[model samples]
Target: MSFIGIKKNITQKDTAEKYIGDVSTYISNNYSNNIKVHDIAKYVNITGAYLFRLFKEYLHTSPQQFLINFRMEKACELLKDCNFTTGQLARSIGYRDVLLFSKIFKKSFGISPSDYRKQL
Candidate 1:
């Protein structure tokens, strides 16, 4: 009696896989902009709540955490160019707040952006 034929048709594993793929693609494609969970979920025709649940159940993390890690990873790669300042790098990875970017960056790498560039 379900709209999608049956409730059993949509297993957690299937939903998790679909969510992961959609989120990964959306982030990879729009990491330079202000992306959000609601936007990605809407794009994939799913509810934001479902996206959060799938991310927590399968990935063991929230969408926001995943996005932060993804952005930090991208920022590290971009750092190799040695042409961007902390603010520039932060903005480059879709973060407008340099303080927040520095906090997240230190949390991920155990070093501040200035210290990171000094090491390079």
Candidate 2:
């Protein structure tokens, strides 16, 4: 008889949870650009692959997605009070391309940065 079983590994969801918390803390405390998946895994004592799997399994998203969302959310907050152009805003949020930032910002917020600021 042949049987199939699921792989058993990394059962402690708490580790992944801790990693998420640590990653968030690191992003908040350090520059947004510094929060890479490798750095996050190193900070949480996990391999990059393991951390990626953990985030996908529990959060249903990749670490990059989380970081991008976090950055965009912060940018939205700053947009309300700051008068920086889109290029400046992109740089402030660790985005190297103003065009790319605008595309992402528009997709996430349903408006470009300029439009968002005008609403504020």
- Model 2, 1-120: lDDT tens digits are 223222223336666677788877876765446456677778778788987897899899998788789889889888987888888888888788889889999988899888888888
lDDT of each: 0.86, 0.79
Model 1 root mean square deviation, Cα atoms:
3.8
Q: Candidate 2: list runs displaced more than 4 Å.
A: 1-11
RMSD of each: 3.8, 4.5
- Report the C-alpha displacement of residue 115, candidate 2, in angstroms: 1.0
Query: Candidates' TM-scores?
Result: 0.84, 0.78
* Local lDDT at 48 for model 2: 83
Candidate 1 stretches with Cα past 4 Å from truth are 1-11
lDDT of 1 at 8: 62
Distance from true location, Cα of 42 in model 2, Å: 3.8
Any residue pairs clashing in model 1, and if so which?
none
